[model samples]
Target: MVSKVNDLDYFVAASEQEALILELNLIKRHHPRYNVRLKDDKTFPYLKIDLNEDWPRVHITRRLEEDGGRYFGPFASAKSVRQTLKLIKGIFPFRSCSKPITGTDTRACLDYDIGHCLAPCIGAVSQKEYAEVIKRVILFLEGKQERVVQQLKSKMNRAAEALDFERAVRLRDQIQAVEQVVEGQRIATTVKGEQDVIAFAGDKDQACVQVFFIRSGKLIGRESFLLQGTR
Candidate 1:
């Protein structure tokens, strides 16, 4: 007889996203043979931006917690995850360092000099403005390409009207980045839900299951699995 899930120890997260992340970690660490398909080497990475923090720096992590931070992926690999991060950071100019944003620094760091960070440590960007930038980053990650594009267009127009051509050019680049990501996704549905569309192709001995992840009406990413003992 199979043991009941309720009879086993369990941990709860604040949301389904966190719970799913936890389940993946547990399956990975334990290597339960029952989850042969999921234990494959293609461990998807995540873009973790802790909005809960005052100076949220984006990170790529495989682990998740219930700390109220926004989780982006389960991406196919580190390379692709970094590509997405690059796009967002290039446009938003968030802090790349892990240092705490205590605002006590005497001068800007190398990241600030290199145009990689907004230098929140020295008040280069106000907290409210940084929060807005982070919001845009979140929107981009959430696959709301149209919304982000519109926001950028509005900002670009304002910059141009104010004779800030340099700012307008930057906004244009940001719009393009958002659109580039959107253009690549093959729309799977018009439904409203965070769900996976699973399909498989195989024979009696083995099979490969493809999972297309859709969130907020956009296809975010996908993972495929090769499995044993297919019926």
Candidate 2:
């Protein structure tokens, strides 16, 4: 490999994270013969929320497209992505149906009956109201639980002030759920802020890398990647 290479060039990055980004971007863009294995994105899935639709639904998608949709992750596996989706659904309980949203449907689906959806099909929630839910989902997925909690609290207070005790109670339940998850993830860490912990293992011809994304001393996500050209 060294004999085949004619020249070498490099760029300096401002930080270690920036350097890693540059390396991955270059590998993805150029698809170097030796590092081609690392460029494969099919090994993981991302959480996509297509903003193009009137009622955006959260789902797992392998491809990351630039279609104005908000994407959350390249999770380690489908199972992990599904687990996260389940948690989000339990808390937010937005609409998960595929039917066109005309807001004139006669009946709600089973998901709405089971408390898994807001049932926007029958005008259970207006678009503006549903957008608020999506905003919280995005914040929660971005590891901004504190912001979500604050927003929930504010909404709950407003609901209470409006004499809507039922809605306020539901918001209270959501707040407790979010707090429980956050508390369960709390642990000791030597690092002070957001940090990415990376580990590598390899043989002569191939290698694997594991990365843990930590925020506020909690592990937010994990991923592993395989690479070639170690020979």
Candidate 3:
């Protein structure tokens, strides 16, 4: 049970459903003592790809809003999210900024110089090219490793044919990173149509609820929730 606080805040929603969602996101972020808790005493991290912006950037956040951006995760832990993000940045040169892209700058940022970003903001890379990188990242997060690898291989071949050996080498590295990062995640359920499948596992002290989204006979993504209460 949570102890009484000296101050409190209230939120207003137009409907009960909206109110419920607001409460859930709040509790998920705060993890109040009276609410379900996660391991490490921290909230899960969400992989937020802000699609609403002209130049999208992948951000890790705990809050979910009504914005048009796409989100993934409620991962097992924040650490896992960080690891996944490191792997993503290693392979995909997606921008990590929230600012609007303007190509007026004379020079690209350090991220572009180091090859962490494709520098769409500074006109070093076209929107179409940057979008292709983001697409590979989205595929990676969606657990479509084989598809991403094939796409990268095709892109590499095209770059090589164009005599862009540098770009071809980068694509080859991205393909290798995809293969190395995406490991064996076995299917836990029987064959079924498109659905959101959930499974739970834990002992008396804690519990974990893992939800797997499957479509077209493939696991698209997964979200995990941890509970501290006993059975």
The TM-score, computed over Cα atoms with residue i paired to residue i, of candidate 3 is 0.65
Cα lDDT over the full model 2: 0.85
lDDT of candidate 1 at residue 177, scale 0 to 100: 68
lDDT of 3 by residue, 42-126 (tens): 4456899877667788979877677987788666567878887887888788888766679767777788888888887778888
Cα lDDT for residue 187, model 3?
A: 48
lDDT of 2 by residue, 30-117 (tens): 8898887559654347899989988899998876677999987666568999999999999997887677889899999888887678
Residue 109 of model 2: what lDDT?
88
What candidate 1 gets wrong by more than 4 Å, as runs, is 1-46, 61-68, 73-84, 100-115, 121-123, 188-199, 214-217, 229-231
The collision pairs in model 2 are: none
**Could you tell me every candidate's TM-score relative to the true structure?**
0.68, 0.78, 0.65
Tell me the TM-score of model 2.
Answer: 0.78
The superposed Cα distance between candidate 2 and the true structure at residue 230, in angstroms, equals 15
Candidate 3 segments exceeding 4 Å error? 1-43, 183-231
lDDT against the true structure, each candidate: 0.80, 0.85, 0.77
Better of 1 and 3 by TM-score: 1
Worst 10 residues of 3 by lDDT: 35-44
In model 3, state the lDDT of residue 119.
83
